[model samples]
Target: MQITPDGNIVFILPAGPLGSLPISATIVNTWIVMTILVVGGRLITLGMGPAAPASRWHLALEILIEQIRKQIQDVGGGDPGRYLPFIGTLFLFILASNVLGVVPGFTSPTGSLSTAAALAICVLVAVPFYGIADQGLLGYLRHYLRPTPLMAPLNVLGEISRTVALAIRLYGNVMSGTVIVAILLSIAPLIFPILLQLLGLLTGVVQAYIFAVLAMVYIAAAQGDEPGAA
Candidate 1:
């Protein structure tokens, strides 16, 4: 992946296997990683007792729990506990999937538009549904119309655009990383790609964080938090 001065992004990877299904390598790898994350996270958390986290697994789970809890509190303010479950699950799932992608021959699901779009859609739908449910339809609409009448339509448009932009941003970042590394390796199978691979690792983690953080921000904004709330 190449980063441009104007903040443009580029990703490269092998041409996806062409067929009726169009299920590319990245898609398959993403599904596998996400499946493991879901199943593993469930098993790990399930083993934890209700009391203070005693075991190593429980302790790690507690740290993740605290992180999500803190993010919700920071963004959603009063009674944000209601959003804890959804936000927490999303953060952990994405974090796990992303880290798993750094493994050799694996690709970040967030690198694919399909995966990112699915996640973005979930956030987009959840935000407004939760907003109206919590604040009432009238109040929710009012929030959109606030500060000015004309800005309401624009604000709503921005909300929709935000979801689309979020998906593209992540997809571009990860896919581009994969492409650049492939190109470097093709040029010369040497120590250079090792450094690039490390860069890929960092990129994966950062992109995951950005996606998770933005998901919370979008939800918070819809719930009437100030702009840049998350």
Candidate 2:
């Protein structure tokens, strides 16, 4: 099975009628996912005015946002609204990337290590961003030097290691699912792939949920021990 989405060239765009740029399937598919999200979000809010009745899509979006906020509040134990946007985007993007793979000829960006690594890097940055926001920069930095100054290196190492683990975990699950189905398709050529594809849909959703929850936990933990910080 192909390990990276780069191997799948979805299309090429002409450059000045002289040369063409070969776009990876990952980039094309990512654009598709982003467009879907942006349009869906806009539509969901368009009908969600004081003068307008709530549509089913608006209601579903509210339920989802509230559930995400509840998760943040539970983990971080502070105002969830501050953290909701980042966490919600992460969940939705990953969910869309994985679920879209269920469609014929669509390859998931999350199945590619590059996409997974980029997301993990975002989380790595977010941990410190939220930590410094909730606590002063000095206050957040103190966590790295906790107990003793010598532990600082280990603490920093832990941070990078966990981020790497996060990327690998996400990429591995999505990649393995795709690989398994491909191999099974070659063998059965018909029915088992359909069943496995349905199972994969659930797995993809679960992976998205797990990734988001873990991200919330990481950010909340970094929010410091100060009152109202977490």
Candidate 3:
């Protein structure tokens, strides 16, 4: 494994049969991120008060809550505040993991397929759960067969495809950026690497935004909203 200038360690995929194991530095980093999402997010929620305080954590969390609330309102058009906790946590975790690649000795958990796939799967499952809770199971499933009974199978396929696409899109984008920069740094250890780093920063934010937007879309769809409605 070689450490890049960004401080991310790169491990080339192994060639042999043992390459498919679930355990790796990537997996470990993902577990740490998961822990942070659960523990840190819960603490933030538990500690929040209607009265304002000057604590940095509360201030930062307030900004995050506002951002998530706006995003949900823009896309969902309902009580976005209610979903802000989970949606905000998801956004923060993903944004953190994506940006973590810039830190030394840290690999972006999102650059790994397993991690991205796991997150996408969670979003997929959560949609149905939230939908059932909000709209009832019958209403949620009725959405699948909506407008035309013949399109139910296609709707099901579309749902699964969106989840797969979310995973693959994030994995491919981050992994490709890392690989390209590695190649560039190997060939020329100069100012061009800095340009690549700048580009990575932009790409990281875009990927995070795309993931969050798609997640809202899934949740909106689950609630029987028209695709173009929101």
Candidate 4:
């Protein structure tokens, strides 16, 4: 029931060799999540025969991959295959990070503003990366001018503002949920907190979906088209 906004620092590099470098719980938990995903993914796809009837695990994986590919195709327009890996990874990572908080003794790395900002920054960078890849540099930058040259500064501001909004939106939602549950546990019965935790899981999944969708939308916009537009 301890509620500190920024997570506890679990390790610090000694100042004897270099200035002290502290690593917080958020970074540690992120590494844990990454390890889980990599190991789990490898184990799940270890063996597969190219046959008519696939294993249940393989079937389920295929379905998930198909759905993600379809969503990217529908939302991002140009070659879904190109964006699938990044978008799919983003969704899965965020979803896992969000749900990890429900485990006892585990706090979601995403609850920290720094983590959220980092994720948002990834999307911010990816938007231009994909855009520049799809269209040439001049073509991608041309969008900034839009209807006229006067709108360039406003467009730049809009990009910065949206990145900030993405970070704040995710950090505020995850942090508030954690804080509320902690406060309630101190004041109310355990059953209520349990129910809230379940709801939080659902919220986490939704947030992951929203974050992924928004990222795709930004990429689509940067590529010079509206999402879902043929």
Candidate that scores best on lDDT: 2
Cα lDDT listed for each candidate: 0.72, 0.89, 0.78, 0.87
TM-score order, best first, reads 4, 2, 3, 1
Cα RMSD to the true fold for all candidates: 6.4, 2.6, 5.4, 1.7
* Predicted candidate 2 versus true structure: per-residue lDDT over 19-58, tens digit per residue: 9988888888888999999998997799578788988888
Q: Tell me how far the alpha carbon of residue 117 in candidate 2 is from the true structure, in angstroms, after superposition.
A: 0.5
Query: Where is the poorest 10-residue window by lDDT in model 1?
Result: 2-11
Instruction: Name the candidate that leads on TM-score.
Output: 4
- Where is model 3 poorest over a 10-residue stretch in terms of lDDT? 1-10
TM-score for each model: 0.80, 0.92, 0.81, 0.94
Candidate closer to the true structure by lDDT (higher is better), 1 or 4: 4
Report lDDT (Cα) of residue 117, candidate 3: 90
Per-residue alpha-carbon lDDT of candidate 3 for residues 17-85, written as tens digits (9 for 90 to 100): 766433467766877778877787788667467674557787887787788788887887678876776
Backbone clash numbers for all candidates listed: 3, 0, 1, 0
Distance from true location, Cα of 96 in model 3, Å: 0.5
Please give the distance, in angstroms, between residue 153's alpha carbon in candidate 2 and its true position after superposition: 0.3
Candidate 1 residue 177 Cα shift, in angstroms, is 1.0
The parts of candidate 3 lying over 4 Å away from their true place are 1-22, 34-52, 226-230
Count residue pairs with overlapping backbones in model 2: 0
1 versus 3: better lDDT goes to: 3
* Candidate 1 lDDT (Cα, 0 to 1): 0.72
Model 4 regions more than 4 Å off: 1-5
Give the alpha carbon lDDT tens digit for every residue of 1-230 in model 1: 43211122223344557523334555566568668977887887785667755778878877877877776667666565777777766666666666766577556666667777888888888888888987899888888887898898898898889989987887788778777877888898787688887887777777766776777777777777764444
